[model samples]
Target: MGRLLSKEDVLAYAIASTALSTGGGGVGPSLESVAKMYDDAIAKGARPELIELSEVPDDAIVTSVVATGGGVSPEMMMRWGGRGGRLRRDLPFGRFDPEYIRDKILENDATWCPLNSWSKIPGPDFRRKAWERLKELIGGKEIFSRLFFEISPFVTRDLCYMSLEGMKAIDATCAGYRAAPEISQSGLNLADVKCTPAVITTVWGDLLILEEVLCFQRAEEIVEGIATYSGGVAGGPFALTGKEAKKGMIPGCISFTIDIGKAILKARESGDDIAEAIVDASKGRAFKLFEGKIAEYWQEPKYSFIWGMVKIKGTGKYAGHRFKAWYKNEFHISWLDDKPYVTSPDGINVIDPKTGWGLANFWPAEWEPGREVVVIGVKNDERWETPRGLKLFGPQHFFFDIEHVPIDKIYKNFE
Candidate 1:
């Protein structure tokens, strides 16, 4: 028998999924987008069934789905304000309200503003005034056009939706299978599965959707692509046999994230200590590495990943210590007082000290200088520690000229 997925289950799965993405060294998608996907799926009467991998046949086909894309930082968006092209900020009302311009572009009615009217505007100044008028009529608020482009791609969310769509397609076809004389009377168990005829997992912002009946065994390659394309910010492959894949791929990762999210929400509702609750929910998997204000943060888009470093000056118990984290899409390496602290494969997450919310890897705008944060490290799957796994996802693979030291070894002094 399969466990029936409820709304709470879906919520838990979404939250845990995000954590798996971030904790596994990938830049996670927005919590809002992921939650919305699960909510929509549940509303449509889609039931996600969780089954152990051992229950699946060795030949059963499985596919992976993940989100892929880096987000534009606020600074980048602001810099592109005056530039022309898709990100141009000098267009009419472009400076005042980007959303208004977006609505106009999306509008289908020709009578409102003919396409030629845009060309008729005499000059830049005239066009500006025209946009201003339109903004006034639409009650637009002041917002930069570049800011409108800051919405990061939620590939994981799309992957989930795509999986649901694929299932629906399979159901339409499988109805004929049920009528076949040779087919079992028990019918196919589709409702209890997240992915039809297989399993599904994700990394931050990237998903690989494949057909169930298809003998696509390129998951290892897909995982490699995620790491290489992200410049070593994401997690490496959990390449295993079908049974091992079911048992070892971040066991209960979805449920774990959901539990953490739920615990935080419940704590916030009851005016309890959210940070404490998060620590409790993680069951010793998560711990505060440093508490400090961000002193410096520098990031640039390199090879499709947000490559950067963040320096924080410790406050309170960790005062007088300086911490530095180098990241590629996700926070991969960290130093405490010039000694190696947390390294890749082990999850390094930044939590807002005030809100106890974990920050996403791509949203540098959210990690403003002077903002207080608690750097937390969650243990990576033991599979990531093996020789082959380390070679694929360790510090060396990330081009760091250092050995793969465990977080416990580095943080033993602090503990």
Candidate 2:
């Protein structure tokens, strides 16, 4: 029999899950959203059960719902909103705006000669037509491709919003699944019983689609497919975020997220320091790396992820020391005084030093300058540190050529 999920348990799971979602850096679902899910479940006499993946039969089917994508700048959102939130397709030259093209050249330091003429084109509409005419005159097929690349930020922001919607849809679908007669009839035994097994996840903003549901001979195969297909740890694997993926499946991941959230709330109520409380509650699996104010930050939409960096000036006992963190959707690497301190597969988080509230990757706009924060690092499952896991989520996977180092080794001096 599975453990019945109480209202409090649901809230706890959400809090922890949210922490896990951003690698403990940002907020996940609001408390109200979590509460609503629990309330609805209770009302429908649908009790969510918590069970270990090992307990399930080998023949069961399972699926994972993982979040992807990264933060979008407010500037991009406003720019698209002003254009009615629809991507402009009427391109004589393409979607490249004059200012956008100029910025691209400047960003690249004018290595490309053709972009230098961008400023000569007057007005957005005129610039598009002029670029088109120039491309035709020069017989440059690559010109349009370059133009699209320059304007990709806008398209990325639009996709970010769409991906967010997909996350919500998954959540709703999971709720529906839990309340269905099949789940109840199966006595909440996800495995052994014949019913669809779905694992809904929360993480960065990225979109994934399953053209059709495919069956597997074993449940573990399904878990592996989801983790690999979704890009594994860096891509959105549960193990990379501290949730266990066994035989490729995570049994109590949803409940686990809620449990972490509850622990945070309990610690806060007890008047304990939030970071310390989280560490203690996790049995020392989570720890604070540094506490300070954000000194510098930068982010841009790249490909399908938000590439960014954050700099922090340490405060209190750690004052005078500087720290830096680089992120792709989630924090992937951190440096202390220019030395690699922690890398991906290990959770990196920025939280309120006082309240322990996790800060989102895209929150620099509203976070203000010099806002106090504490950087937290939580150890991930050993499985994530393996050869195959590293390939999918290691520093090299994120475009960094550095070798993978365990968090414990990097922070050994601190201990």
Candidate 3:
């Protein structure tokens, strides 16, 4: 049986998903939009629900729904001052009222929810076109649900918006617990699931259906091209059936994110240490890597991805050590005191000790010099340790010469 999600679950999932994003995906400002989405759903009397993968009928049609685009930091828009694009330069991403987000951002008239397309919000038009195209391609089979492509605040927000439209949320994710830079990095791809027969859509109402793709790499390039040209896009390849989803997707990840979120919220209310609470919430899969202050940070938007590095000077017990991490939207590599420490296929979560929110690489200004942060390394799903998984997500894929090491082996409960 499936369970209905309470309004609080949506809010909790937002905070938890951001904290687990490993410093990529959407950032903090987007949470305000999520809050409004749930409120709107309640006003409409829609109940968002989640069901286990086993509960889905074997023949049910599904597709991974995701937004594609380079995210612009809200702080960047304030600097550009409406000169770069159609978005209002006056307010940051979260600064807009719900009406403004609903009227402007959600309507695709302007940009918010991190990209110019506003596909992350899955507004009415984007939703309609995507479903129409997907249903058409699938020969009018009822698309039972929209599968979450990644674990991030944007997807969590979209889940609420989608639930209101009658799509049951599956408590699973194709991209595992943390965000990855490429679609091919997903557990689905590693499990040899096909990504073709895909649908791609732009906010301008344009649609492109890739009847077939030679490989996931080609599919990724094509999607990247569309996003690069249109500033952003939304839509995904048909996931076909529940059997395929169960085989490829990481199950229970949404529930896991919510549990972590609830833990953080509860700890905050009880005045408990947020960092410790997060580790406890992760249930031994996560451990403290470094506690420090941001010393230097540099990031640039390149090829529709946030690319950068951060240097942290340790404090407290970690004093005298230094930490460095590099990212292409998501952190892929890190070094502690000049020695390779943790790498992708493992999660490196940078959290603000003050608020327990994951500090995003794009929002450097918010986590600028002197901000205290707790870096947590989370063990990736055991499935990610397979040879095929490592080939796709390991350090080699990121141009690093080091061998892939599990987070547990590298940190081993560094308290």
> In terms of TM-score, how similar is model 1 to the real structure?
0.59
lDDT of 2 by residue, 155-260 (tens): 1121112222221101111211011101111111222222222222211112232222343123323433333322221121111111111233223334444445
Ten-residue stretch with the least lDDT total in model 2? 144-153
Per-residue C-alpha lDDT of model 1 across residues 64-165, encoded as one tens digit per residue: 222133433444333222122232211233222445333333341343434443343122233233334333433453321100001112323432443344
Judging by lDDT against the true structure, name the best candidate.
Answer: 3
Tens digit per residue, CA lDDT, model 3, 66-109 = 34556444453332211132232123533223343355444334
| Model 1, position 212: C-alpha lDDT score | 41
Q: What is the C-alpha lDDT of each candidate?
A: 0.46, 0.46, 0.74
My TM-score estimates for the predictions, one after another, are: 0.59, 0.58, 0.85
Ranking by TM-score: 3, 1, 2
**Which stretches in model 3 have alpha-carbon errors above 4 Å?**
29-36, 65-67, 71-127, 232-237, 412-415
Ranked candidates (lDDT, high to low):
3, 1, 2
Better of 2 and 3 by lDDT: 3
Task: RMSD for all candidates, in order, please.
Answer: 15.4, 15.8, 5.9
